[model samples]
Target chain A: MSDTSRTPTEVDDAALIERARREPEAFAEVFRRHAPEIQRYVTRRLGADPAEDVVADTFLAAFRQRERYDLSRSSARPWLYGIATNLIARHKRIEVHQLRVLERTGTDPVSDPFTERSDERLSARSVRQRLAAALASLPAGHRDALLLVAWGGLSYQEAAQALGVRIGTVRSRVNRARNKMRKELGGVDPTSSISEVHVRG
Target chain B: MDEMTQLDRLRSEIPTPELSGAAERRLLAEIATSSQPRPARRQRRRVNLGLGLASGLAAAVTMGVVITNGDSGDPGQTPTVQPYSMAAVTLQRAADNTSKQEELHPKPGQFLVFESQTMDPVDSNNENGHSRFLSRSKRTVWLPVDGSSLDGVLFMEVLPPKPYPGWPLPPEAKQEVGTRGPDRLADFDQRAEYLRTDYAYLSSLPTDTAGMRKHLYLELEPGARADYEAWDRVGSMLAEGYLPAAQRAALFRAAATIPGVETVKKSEDAAGREGVAVAMVSTEAGERQEYIFDLKTYQYLGQRTVVVDADKAEAPVGSVLTATALLKVSVADSAPVVNGG
Candidate 1:
């Protein structure tokens, strides 16, 4: 093993990648490191159960393409984030379907859709309602770029990778998504709207 | 309206998802069985290696072979691998009026697929050419090409080789393990061959836990084996004509015109294949580029771009462009001959 004490962050990523390269099992180390963040990310976009599958799928995809991982960069967060974004994007129809289902059934896995909790649920529900309407009304490119960067925590660059578009293009999509959301929510910007939505919940 | 707050609020609202315990177990099991196949003498060697690594000293070694789910196999049971699914918010093209699907599948392939946006490594107005990244996470179907199971699956995540001190500048990690061509490519092939031989020996070992342990080490270090299974795809593309040689200079010139192109140079591959190695700064627009051309035939071997840094860059972080002849260009049966009208 290379000297850990002297190993740099990039070197550590290389070692993890090399380990992942040789033994698909070695990818588990990378999963362990990033799974929590990934899990949280998925849970936010999708509920707990769906999040689980998405997280697993993200790592599996990363493991399969571990060799393609650019060693020039160390952190796997952006790459993983990119993968998760794509995974989530694929389920857009299901997401809308799920929101509608929740609207009707009032139950999602993470939170009690039935319980009219006055905490975050109200805001989440309002957000869910707005999100569903906003999402459906959104241009696919704009919505995808915005959601990937916003929920996936991917930087503009990383979001661009996930979307396979120029950074300038990503910026535009994000701007459009936000502007649309703002207009729909009475121009209450996604940021403060979220806080108010949560506060009243 | 600050970018960070907007991004943070969005992140908080839409959380990442999770996986079922059963699926996780199955995936791990699949990886274990496929990547690590055991034999005897090498098994003994692996026991020693495992002991050395685990304890850092060779002491009492009570090696245990724990086959988690290997017992219930009917050999022909064909494990019920999970299926992949997707839902896209189709977009309408103004010119055609036909809805264009965006960010549908993450990685589009034969079995499972995850179609995503085309990654732009370098922001050139080059239509139909984007540095898009593909990963298996979006989809879950195993590839059926050439008897490749999840076990023999080889993925190449482009990583810059080890750096020289303060590399990668501020915001980005230095590119390590830079591009490989001809000589180094040859060297890599040799190494793969050596690992294959080692694997052969390990596989030949008697069915014991110790032997299996040895096989694990041999299979785990992807670099130990010189004959890369995946690169053969790159080589085969070279042998074919998908990437014409004359267009390489044009491709590079096109790449150079990209907004963030940097560090262009002529270099030899690990296997002695002649090509150019470029170091590019991270930009939402800058895309990594690679081109391999046969010096003798002047035929384009392979061209690939990979996303080097995703944080300050885009998702494909790196990418590649294979020869054109090898491409299985598909067109709709009733589609227009020119523009698929």
Candidate 2:
């Protein structure tokens, strides 16, 4: 009865999406609540210059396709990531090339050493370079699955749903990708400070 | 470098670019105004030149509703910036000549083997505060050309600096090795990835010269704007990265268009490789980066950084910061094994 000035945080993504289906103005609240994180995720994959367009395209696509979103999923993170991956794939050559560059250089193209702290935990430049090379060498589907879980914070099932793959496929893809990385990188210490950094989107 | 450390770094160290406050507001404002549904029509590519960065994404939302309904134009084009001219002619010539070289396609199992004398400034403290000394050492690295489970490459020290015997090792490395003497060569793990190069990424560069310029110049502004060295960055990338044939040519062509490019008809590099050179001097930094190429083949010989002004570099003029000379690049079936024992 007292739903007049409900905050975006009070409700879930699915509920907000359902409301936007009727009163599309309400969709702006959805953008306000999650745009920063979504924008950050896209920026992690694409550099800032292209991230601007990606963030814009992602929300607009989400807005237009709001009706098709499954109401069962409480959180929209997976759906948003799926769309972000789709837009990223639309520029596949550039994406892969950028990944390769990151891998070869042992440094993120987006990282500005002046404003940001150099990750001393990175164990020097050579190791980071190897990791980048390993990541760049991964199969597209496998990389997507691994990244969806590791970077996107999606569960295996959620990743499966995001990539439109079976749970088994997701498991294998993630396993194969992780194993390859471990083999190339030497057995990684999962408890390291670096692994703990991906707590957010 | 250890593999696990690298993986951890990849997860944490990579910096993510941030969204500007105005960008978020602009998107939200558009959404606030265009909430009303409109008649559906053929989606044409709409580009708002006023906002170059957001035009592509804004187009999607603007199309279905009454957003940016003003400039209704054709579909699929974003407004692009104009190109500036510099010493791109020399770069294009170099690229063209390099591209014409017989392409050496390596099978997946092979490695890209290179031998080089890497010269870096090794700063040491003695009775007299500190001094920067150039240390030249020979290094040979075998990098896997294929993404294979072999999961390893080889790094070897061919020659240790002898005259002044200087190879700076981290205190941790010194403690780990428990050695004060510079023997240089040592048996290493098979999984060591001492050399990192991605051929896959090289071919992915913009085939068109203009596209290459756009990609580099736009990205360079936020990073190198202080020294007006964006073109130099592009030139350095071309000189350093092993770009594919077409893209390499395109990069050279693009470099020709950069501003303030200077050429020296004859120059001898640190390694004494005789070649013609192209350079860019950063007035503020009082340093210059020169990329030397063979006169006959225009093949990249090496690159070096030299101080042009003492006040800027905070060192004596003519001091060399870094230098590297490429010796040989070839695809080998496997790394040449040496018995360290």
Q: Pick the candidate with the highest DockQ.
A: 1
Question: For residues A105-199, what per-residue lDDT tens digits would candidate 1 score against the true structure?
Answer: 43443344323543444243444444445555776677667766776557788777666689999998888877666554553344444355433
TM-score of each: 0.39, 0.40
Off by over 4 Å in 2: A1-9, A112-123, A187-201, B1-8, B11-21, B29-341
Tell me what TM-score chain B of candidate 2 gets against the true chain B.
0.57
Model 1 stretches with alpha carbons more than 4 Å out: A1-11, A100-116, A121-128, A187-201, B1-27, B35-341
DockQ of each: 0.12, 0.09
lDDT per residue as tens, model 2, B90-148: 56678879766877676667766555544543333222222233334444445456543
Q: Which whole-number lDDT from 0 to 100 does residue B190 have in model 1?
A: 12
Give the alpha-carbon lDDT of every model: 0.36, 0.52
Candidate 2 has an lDDT of: 0.52
Q: How well is candidate 1 docked (DockQ)?
A: 0.12
Q: What is the C-alpha interface RMSD of model 2?
A: 17.2
